[model samples]
Structure formats: structure tokens, C-alpha cells
Target: MPKVLVQFAHPAFSRSRVHRVLLKNCKQLEGVTVNDLYEQYPDLYIDVKREQELLLSHDILVLQHPFYWYSGPAIIKQWLDLVLEYNWAYGPKGYALLGKKMINAITCGSGHHAYTSEGHHQFPVSQFLLPFRQTALLCRMDYMPPFIVYGTHRMQQDAIEEEGLVYADILSGLASGRIRPEHYGGLEIINSLGHGAMS
Candidate 1:
């Protein structure tokens, strides 16, 4: 089984409706380590070394968070800045994450259409996440299409719960090696594999 690390960043999990529900079952998986950035670094002081070590110990990395203003929470950006060092994650000797895989699990306040050019947000959700993809690329990691929960504010309670359960299954699959990196190649929404493969 692959060791998976789920790095969750939520500026306000206490008052969150979608993110809190989505995180309900993430820590229950055996080989999946759930690291809540805000919970750990409430003071905004992230231990760079420890974070790098966690990355080295995991085969797959999941960045789970709510999409705020088309970007991740402040802590995630800070973590990325401090933990992913030039000599360790990118530069000449930065091969620590070369073959590892990365996936983004995000919740958007608007529906899928809101991300389109014809919609309110102006561009596709994928466009908003390109920076994350590029970061993984620079580190030589395999970045997968993100698992998304669209229309967060519009989703019914049952739908929100179902999405949360599906997220748990996604993490479980990654940890158990049931979900291959190639399986994400053609998927636009990673959650589509929720039913058949996740179960």
C-alpha cells in the first residue's frame, strides 16, 4: 500500500459547512495521514523540516481545501513556500518528490458552470489550479486532475454528505494503491471514479 499524506487547509473550519463535512472521515484511513495545516500552525509557524520529512514518507500527496478566491488558504501557500525548498523539491538536488503523485481536492462556492468563460468566475476551475499543477511539475511530481465539490452553497445536505463520503473513499483508494495515477489521466473531475473504483 502506498503511504498517502493529506494536507488540509481551511482558514475557518469552525464555521465551515462544506469543508468540515468533507473532512469528517479523512483521518480514519490506516495509511493515510491527515495534517490539518491551520490546526497545526495556528501561529503560522510551520516546521519546514518536518513537513519535508512527511513528504518523503508518503507516496501520494493530497491538497484538500476550500477554493477561496480561486486559490488555497494562506497557510497552504506558506507551507508550499517554506517546505518545498529549492535544493530539496526543485533545484539540482531537489528530487525528493520526483516520482510522487499529487491531487487537489477542492470545494467551490459556485457550480461547475461558474468556472467557465461564459460564467461568473470567468475561467475554468482547472485554469485557477494551474499554479498548483505547475508547482508539482517543477518538483517532477505526477499531478492529477482535482477532485471537486461544485455548487457548495447550493448543494443539498445529502449531496454534501455524499461528496464527503466520496472524498474519504478517494483517500482510501490512493492509500491502498487501488487508484492508479494513470486512472486520472482522462478524468475532468476526480470524483467520477468515486463509485466503481472507490467502492
Candidate 2:
């Protein structure tokens, strides 16, 4: 089984109902590790060597965070800046993360339509994630399509639960080698994991 590490980063985790549910479900799985970035580094003092060692040990890396300003929070950017160094994650002699798999688990308050071409954002959310995608490429990791939970602000209890279940199943599937390679894309709720359109 793949050792999946979820790098969870939420500034106001106590106030997040949606992400709380998402994290709760995924945390129960056997081989999945939920590393709360905020709880670990409240002051954003990231341990680059420690983070690098965690990456080296895990087969799958999940970056779970709230979509702040159409991107990740400051801590995630800081983590990437300090942990994913030039000589360790890339460069001529570096390829320690070559075969690992990565994906972002983002929770957004906006509706799906709001991130389209004719919508307020005027483009797809995937289009805005090129830096992340290309960064994975630079490190030679298999960057899977992001796992998104949209419309979090208006979702009811049942809707939130359903999304949480799907999130759990996706992590479970990835760890157990059940989710296929072709299924990895900018998938909303991992529709490829056989849970129907939970988006």
C-alpha cells in the first residue's frame, strides 16, 4: 500500500466546517497520514529537512488547503519555497521525488460556474494552477488532477457529508492502488473513483 501523506493547511481550521469534515474522514484511513501544517507551524517556521524527509518516506503527497485568492495560503507557498529546494527536488543531480504522486485537495467557497470562461473568474480553475502543475513536472513527480470541493459556502449537511465521503474514498483508492492512472486529472471530487458526480 502507498503511504499517503496529506499536508493539510488551513489558517482558520477551527472555523472551517467543510474542511473539518473532509479532514476527519480522511484521517481514519489506515495508511494515510494527515499532517496539519497550521497546527505544526503556527508561526510558519517550516522545517525544511523534516519536510523533505517526510516527502522521501511517503509515496503519495496530498496538499489539502483552502483556496485563498485563487491559489494556496501563504504557508503552503512558504513550505514550497523552503522545502522544495533546487538541489533536493530538482536540478542536475536531484530527483528524490521522481516517482512520487501529488495532488491538491482544495476547498473553495465559490460555485463551479464562477470559475469558468464566461464566469467572474473568466477561466477554469485548472488554468490558474499551472505553477503547481509545472512545479511537479520540474521535480518529475506524477501530478494528479486536483481534488476540489466547490460550493462549500452554500452546501448543506448532506452535501458536505457526501463530499467528505468521496474525499475519503479517493484517498483510500489512491493508497490501495484502486484509482487508475488515466483517472487522475483536474477532477472535481474524484469522479474517477466510482462515486458518481459528487461535484
Candidate 3:
């Protein structure tokens, strides 16, 4: 089984309705390591060497968080800035992450329709995630589609649990390599439809 490192970032997990459950399910899964960024770096002082070491130990990396302001939380950006060094994750002699798998798992406040061109957001969710995709590409990593939970505000308890199960399944599949890279036209498309596979 592939070792998975989930870099979770959430400022208010206790008050969260969706992210908390999603993260909980991920923890229950085997071969998955949940790295709570906020918990580890409450002072915003991320240990660059430690983070890099964790990344090197995992075959797959999962950026699990809520979609805040059309992107990840500020800590995730900080992590990118500090941990993914030029000589390690990119540039010449920076092949530590090459050939590894990367994926995002997010919770959105709006429904699927809200992220469409005709919807309030005026662009697909994929458009908002291009930066993440490009980041993985720059590091020579395969970026898979995200496991998402839409309509978070309107989601009921049972619904959240169901999505949690799906999230767990996604983690399980990815860790076992059952969910191959680019298996669902990238994370944006896979998330747009709950079920993912080759058609």
C-alpha cells in the first residue's frame, strides 16, 4: 500500500460542519497519515526540514481542507512557500517529489451549480484550482482530482456522513493505487461527479 500524507488545514475544525467529518473519516483509513497543519503550527512557524521529511516518506500527498476564498487556507500557501524548496521539490537536483502522486480534498460552501459558468461563481471549480494543478506539475507530480463535498451549509447529518464515506473510499483507493493518476479528467471533473472511473 502507498503511504499517504494528508496535509490538513482548517482554522476552525470544531465549528466546521463538513471538513471535520471528512478529516475524521480519512484518519480511520489505513496507510493514511493525517498531518494537521494548524495543530502543528499554531504559531505559524512550520518546520521546513520536518515537513520535507514527511513529504519524502509518503508516496501520495493529499491537501485536505476547506475551499476558502476559491483556494486553500493561508497556512497551505505558507507550507508551499517554506516546505517545497527550490533545490528539493523543483529546480535542478530537486526531484524529491518527482513521480509521486498529489491530490486535493476540499469542502465548498456552495453547491455544484454555484461553481459553473452560469452560476454565481462565473467559472467552473476547476478554474479556481489550476494553480494547485500547475504546482503539482511543476514538481513533476501527478495531481489527481479532489474529493469534494458541495453545498456544505445545506448538507444534513446523514448526507455529510455519506460524503465522508466517499472521501474515505477515495483515500483508500488512492493509497492502494486503485485510483490511478488522471483517472477522472483531473480532480475538478471527478468532484463535479461523485463517481469516478474511466468511461
Candidate 4:
């Protein structure tokens, strides 16, 4: 089984509807570690050594956050900048994350159609996530397609709960090795597999 670490960042968690349930579901799993960034570092002070150690210990890294302004919240960038140092995460001697896997689990306010070229964003959500992919590549990690919950702005409570269940299923699959990294190849989004498909 893979040791999965979820770096969960939500600036306004109190106001969150989708991530709240998702977090709760992930917590119930056996081998998943949920690291709430804002909750851990409210003052924005990150422990680089500890973060690196966590990365070294985990097999899979999951970046879970709401898609803010086509990217993640400020803390996500801060964590990356402070924790992923030269000669540690990248460069010649930066092999701490080599062979590890990364996946973005993001919640979007708009529906999937809104991220298409003909829609409001005028680009796919995958395009906006290129930086994350490059970062994973630089660290020699396998960057998997993202798991997304679309149209959260108008999602009903039952629908959000269902998405939470799906999120749990995906995490469980990844941790248990039932869902391999190659399963995400050539895929735009993880949720397109639908609930229970990965398992």
C-alpha cells in the first residue's frame, strides 16, 4: 500500500461546502495522512525540514484545494517555495521525490464546460495546471491527472456529498494500489472515471 499524504489548503475553510466533506471522508481512511496547511501554519511559517521529511516518507502526494484564480491559494505557493529547495527537491542531488506520484484534487466553482476553449475560461483546466505538472516533472515525480469537483457554486448538498464519497473512493484506491498512476494517463480529469470505477 502507498503512503498517501494530502496537503490540504483552504484559506476560507469555514465558508467551504465541498472541501469540508471531502476532508472528512479522507480522514476516515486508514493509510492517508491529511495535512491541513492553513490549520498547521496559520502564521504562514513552514518547517522546510519537516515538510521534506514528510515527502520522503510518503509514496503519493495529493494537493487538495479550491481552484483560486486559476491556481491554488497563497499558502500552496508558499509551501512549494519554502519546502522544495534547491539540491533537495530538484537539481542534481534533488532526488528526494524521485519516483513519487502527485495528483491535484481541486474544487472548481464553474462546471467542466466552462473550462473549455468555447467556454468562459477559454482554456481547459488542465492548461491552467501546467505549472504543477512542470513542478512535478522537475522533481522527477509522476504527475497524474487532477481529480476535480466541478460547478460547486450551484451544487446541491446531496451532490456535494456524493462527490465527497467519490473523493474517498479515489484516495482509497490510490492508497491500496488498486488505482495505478497509469490509469490516469491521457485523461483530462480523474472524476470522469465516475464513482467506484477506479476500485
**By summed lDDT, which 10 consecutive residues of candidate 1 come out lowest?**
190-199
Number of colliding residue pairs in each model: 0, 1, 2, 0
Q: Which pairs, if any, clash in model 4?
A: none
Each prediction's whole-model lDDT (CA): 0.88, 0.86, 0.84, 0.92
Q: How accurate is candidate 1 locally (lDDT)?
A: 0.88
Give the alpha carbon lDDT tens digit for every residue of 1-199 in model 4.
Answer: 8999999999999999999999999998978999999999999999888899999889999999999999999999999999989999898875789999999999999998999889999899899999999999999999998998889999999999999988899899888888875776788887877788576
lDDT of 2 at 1: 80
Per-candidate Cα RMSD to the true structure, in Å, reads: 1.1, 2.4, 2.5, 1.0
- Which scores greater on lDDT, model 3 or model 4? 4
Judging by TM-score, tell me the better candidate of 1 and 2: 1
* Tens digit of per-residue lDDT, candidate 1, span 1-199: 8998999999888888888877777777889998999899999999998899999999999999999889998998999999999888989875789999998999999998888889999899999999999999999999988999999888888898888888888888888888886876789888998754645
Query: What local lDDT score does residue 101 receive in model 2, on the 0 to 100 scale?
Result: 86
RMSD of 2: 2.4
Model 2: per-residue Cα lDDT over 85-186, one tens digit each: 987899987888999988988988888898887888887788877788898989999888888887898999899888888888888888877775766655
Query: Per-residue CA lDDT of candidate 3, range 1-199, in tens?
Result: 7899999999998898888788888888788999999999998999999999999999998999999999999999999999989979999876799999888788889998998888999887778988998999999998877677779989999999888777777777767777665566543444444433222
- Using lDDT as the measure, name the better of candidate 1 and candidate 2: 1
Candidate 1 clash total? 0
Ranking by lDDT: 4, 1, 2, 3
Q: Which ten residues in a row have the lowest lDDT in candidate 2?
A: 190-199
